[model samples]
Target: MVPEANPRVGQLTTQWQRGKDKIAAALISLVLIVGVVAQAGFAWQVHLNGEEIGVVKDKASLVALIEARTHEVEADKGYEVGLASQVEFRKIVSFSSDDAEAVKETLSEGLEFGLKATAIIVNGTEVAALATLEEAEGLLEQLKSRFIKTSSNLEVEAVRFREDVELEETYCRVEDIVDKDAALNVLLHGSEKLLQHTVARGESLWTIAFKYQLGVSSLKAANPNIKPEVLPIGSKLSLKLDEPFVRVEVVEKQTYNKSIPFATTYTTDSSLWTWDSKVKVAGKAGAQQVTARIVSVNGKEEKRDILSTQITASPTTQVVARGTKTAPSLSTGTFLWPTTGVITSPYGMRWGAMHSGVDIGAPKGTAIKAADSGMVTFSGWNGGYGYMVKIDHGNGTSTLYAHSSKLLVSQSSVVEKGQVIALVGSTGNSYGAHLHFEVHLNGKQVNPLNYFR
Candidate 1:
């Protein structure tokens, strides 16, 4: 109608319109691609208090990462986050009453927090962040100064990292000293094997062995030359279980000087020398070989060896015979029998036993006298000897009286010759009333017959 609008023109217009629509669609697609590229190229830097810590690529990823980090922090700090933004974050830090009580006391007056702060920059916008609950708690103080209120009872002290720790030093101590070989040697061979006995009246070697839990053979082994059946009472005897040997070697020598004065003089006048003076003498000595013999307890010689000997000092022999030779007075005292009794046993072997001490068979209650002047060293009932008395004469000699029904003297009492010391009886291992008498010299029992007459 409007000048018969050309159909071709109309068709061209429609074509142009379709072309325009296509271009618009292409432009829209290009815009979408640009948006996607921009988003893909978006990057973020994460920092703790301006110190770079990590990076993120896109807005969505950044948000997700921050949320995840916040969750991690919350998990660690046992708290929850409320708001997170580019400028600040708000969180609730919860502490157990038991844990918070101490913190409450320490921070009741307000505490300064040492923050572990993180700054996240996205699209040129800086977002301060705290990743862990501990960081959030630390940031709480800063936020409080900035008028950010938080209901937190968390008081975190500044962390001081250390690579090494100090420890106490220890020292070793010595406890004992050791000499193995010497100790072992002593343990193996240092003990003496011997038996000891104090002689009792009527005790022969046989009776001694019997009383001391040994055999006659053992007693004989200890005492080589002794006849057991005639053992003298009051004698000390040794019974050897084994022979003992010792080795001695001289290790050193020393000398000493000695001056000896031999005589003394008495002067009545102090003038012009009637001279009372003593002569001094010097002595010289040398060394000699010394030998030791190991013997059995029964007096049997087992082994002998020479040890070293050195002169310690010089020796001088000064023999001074001062008394004139005169005949000694003959002893004239009558020897009374110590006990009044019949001689039931003589001083000889009887039946199978050797009679050691003479036995004077007496009725019970017969008085017994000391044979000589001596000190009573023993007054007691000895095994198989009844009651006994031992008198010690000076010079290692002694006498024994046994088989007493009663004792009149105590031990260590002095008695004169012919003093009554006991009443004869059968009080110990005796078959009848009798007095047993024995004699000893230098600790060795000798036959009474040798000295009686």
Candidate 2:
């Protein structure tokens, strides 16, 4: 009835319709897949006391949530908790979010019980921690009482444990709770064990303490029965650790008696002859009672205070008489020994030659003196005489000192009687240290012993 449609046009129309159908089917399939994927499961997140603990997908009941969280918390913290006790649950709905780790961590924190621990501290450092404040304080008191005596005369100024203490809220395990005796032992002696030291020869308590890095008082306190001054050889010494956790300090006042030695005094008498002395009175030691306050730490004295002293018996003072008489000088027709020695050679003729002086053996550097007050005429090296000093007495008398180590006076110097003028030596014509001394009377050599006494 119409013009026959072209075969190519018909084919093109068919292809266009098929492509449109394919695109429609693809859009429908994508919509269905998106709808299925959007559907998600939801659960209630349980929390204790306003804190989120865990989510519940199967059981939405609060009781079931509490039981589950309790068991989980107990297993996580290694401790059990009372069911629904001190616990409040809060539910927060969440979808497609797995918070198992956060829930466990929150439940662990919520189930923990805050514990307060008191610490025994020494020198601002914590030494031990106790369960309760009363226990810690009691331990400190017990340690202080170890050094306190029960005697009526025992006066305690202050008793204290040498450490800083504090109480704080912290987490602790059930096993860490300490008992009374255990706490006391740890508070006093610390965790370190007793170190044994064998006493060696020439080892004293002080040396032992120094070697072990302990106080001498602490060393003595460890062995109360042994004396510190007299230590037995090969004895065992219980040396503890240095700087003990607790130091028991005590102050006491005591009275003791001791002897006071008397002193000697001398009285000079000008009329008494020289080399004469007499004891007028004898001295005797007296007794004194002293009251002192002593402060000791760990049984060792740290400080001492002398309260008062009373003399029980009066001391007898010693009295001695000393002579003050003046000796005669050279101007009084006398001479003194120039030096101290035994005369080895006398002034005489020997070996067919006249020996004009006396030779006295003395040590080198011995002081040589002027026999009498005179003026020095010669002081220098002499032929075969070594260092010599000659003095003119200004009364037709002169003296000579030879063989000296050194000359101390210059020529023309006035010297007093018995004044040091030279030192002994063996300089020339000599084999040893000696002094050849001569006394000349009006140019004639004479025996020096006749002038010296």
Candidate 3:
């Protein structure tokens, strides 16, 4: 200060002070930047319908991962799928970055997919969902064909479902889509589960089989120890019924040759007993070609119509002479009609099996009359005949009345022609209310229709 202030000294001092301040300001800025980097970071938080799933550092990377997951699902399921949940990316400042795999896995767990599928609708109720329409249609076709019985004499006119079956386009959950086979099984079975049946009053093997659309043979096979001739009340029977959910109506035209039955007439002969008769002319069956239109449901015949009948030959009528002098209480050489009804089943080769008796369809409890006067040989429950009555007429002749609801006479009791002996019923292995009538000549079964007048 003494002599004059040195200008260089002053300038150096000023420069030092300015440099110190600059360094301090730089340090402050650096501290501020470090604080910002530590406290906050740019990241993407995944939100599904306002529910946070996960976080990722790079939005584009997360998006790529989600896309990959979608493709993976689509490839595995063999169907196109889309995200069903609401997805949103929120800008967030996270302390640390999240791994791509973790973010994707979390999002995948939270998100749901919508599948494009076809639902099989039966009567407005959805039964099964298939991946494609073609698969649905194929399944329906398979159901229709399941009941078709192919035969050379049949011409399939039409095949359809009884219900309003349709394939509807729909969007379902990813889990709703099923394999073709599974869907088919659902349509085929569909909650119609009837695994067993309990016998009730007036129920027979034929009735049970008809109710479940099962064959009598099949029903017997399912319950090996069951007796079709006697269905005891409250007894359980195993059922093997697998009818489709919707009924399949198969309309077909069948053409085949049928045998025309011969008629038997009588002539008056006062010399013999009323129950005795001698065949003057043997019966010979005529031939006819028949064309019929049949409608079937679930392989069971529902309706049949005879389209045309070409008589190949005229039937030969049998003649028999009976005595008028025989007492009414004893078996005269003549016979009378047992019950008034249509002959349902005839005695002959039926369904490639021998049918030993004629079936007469009548209402239950209808009076069953004796064909001729004879002594009661049997009057009790038979294995297949159910409630039965048998009468023995002299001269190597006997008659049986089967499937009766009640027996009015006992064994060893004598009955005359036109006497009420039993009541009609559908017991045992029978189908409906009917009488199974049989006649034997010389220890051999004969056609009862041929002997009835």
Candidate 4:
């Protein structure tokens, strides 16, 4: 103002003021940018029931971590496990207070937040749930197999679950997810047990089952490969308590043929010896067709019914002839000794019993002669008198030679006096090799010494 405002001084002063204004604007812009950056800062925080669980930069990253933990649990427990899908966020807000690692550590402590899960409902009853429907179905299938029976001739009509299965959303601790296999085992068997049994000598299926308080049918069902009838010694058998969850019924139709045996008949033939026979017809068996219906449950046969029976062929009857021939010999009431031997026991009371005939001692295979024989009546095994030969002497008198080794003549054959009719033998109540001689007059046994010469 004093020097009329020097132009260079005014221009310099204006430049300084403009520079200060530029610096102030730059500082204000920088402060506003810093405030915006601080306000825009974001982090995802997981909370359960208004309680903070963990904080992560991204929600997806937290989910990935939970999945990794689930895989680890699956490997350790040998089952399928996953983070429950029913997890709900109480708050999803920006959280810059902690890093991702600190949040992960806090979640790993399992103190506040829990995993969302699905509940398995069976017929309105809760059972269990997995992370996925496929895994849950797999577990249920395993349970079904435990109750199923195999290797049966019956046809399985259908397999259905006894309960209505459904999946429901729920929440639980991250460690509460059940292992698929173990859960199935616990549901089916109630407890885990493994018992082995070995067969021993004289041990039968019934005995073994009784010893173990088990049923025979259950044993058969458990051991399909072993035969119930022929159980080998030292063979092992698996023992367990059976819990059936499904009813399995099997039906079968069978057809088979059975044989109808033939019958035999005999006719008397007077032309041959007593022991001889001839077959006039041969016997044959017949066939019958049978149809049956069988019903079984859980590999056990429950009922069987025969539908029909048809005779395919008739059986033929067999006819045979038995000989009844006899030899006759004429006599004059006078007789000769049948065999040459010493009389060891005479006809009288012997050993508290009446001796009906004389016992003439002789060697085996000795020749025996008839004493005026008439008709041969009996020849064969006789009670107390073995190999006897009875002859009618035509004059109301008959002669008998017992204990003979062989008979050379047949019945109904004519013979003369003094003929050799039989040989001596030790047969029929005989003490040694001997001949028993007797004579009868009109069916009455008498002394033969009066007629024999």
Q: Which candidate ranks first by TM-score, i.e. highest?
A: 3
Residue-level lDDT tens digits of model 1 in 184-266: 23222334467678788866776777777778887787778766666677777886543212222212122223333333333
lDDT of 2 by residue, 188-266 (tens): 6567668899999999999999998889998888988889889999999998774456677787787778898988999
Candidate 4 matches the true fold with a TM-score of: 0.35
Alpha-carbon local distance difference test for all models: 0.53, 0.75, 0.85, 0.70
lDDT of 4 by residue, 272-328 (tens): 755357788898899998777766664567787888899999999888988775333
Q: What are the per-residue Cα lDDT tens digits for candidate 3 across 349-379?
A: 9999999999999999999999999878789
- TM-score, every prediction: 0.27, 0.34, 0.49, 0.35
Local lDDT at 195 for model 2: 85
Which residue pairs in candidate 1 collide? 73-132, 221-298, 222-297, 222-298, 222-299, 223-298, 285-314, 386-428
What stretches of model 2 exceed 4 Å from their correct place?
A: 1-88, 92-97, 105-113, 116-130, 140-251, 258-264, 269-284, 292-313, 331-453
Model 3 Cα shift for residue 386 (angstroms): 21
Q: What are the per-model numbers of colliding residue pairs?
A: 8, 1, 11, 13
Among all candidates shown, the one with the greatest lDDT: 3
Relative to the true structure, candidate 3 reaches a TM of 0.49
Cand. 4 Cα-lDDT: 0.70
For each candidate, C-alpha RMSD in Å?
A: 29.3, 21.7, 16.8, 15.7
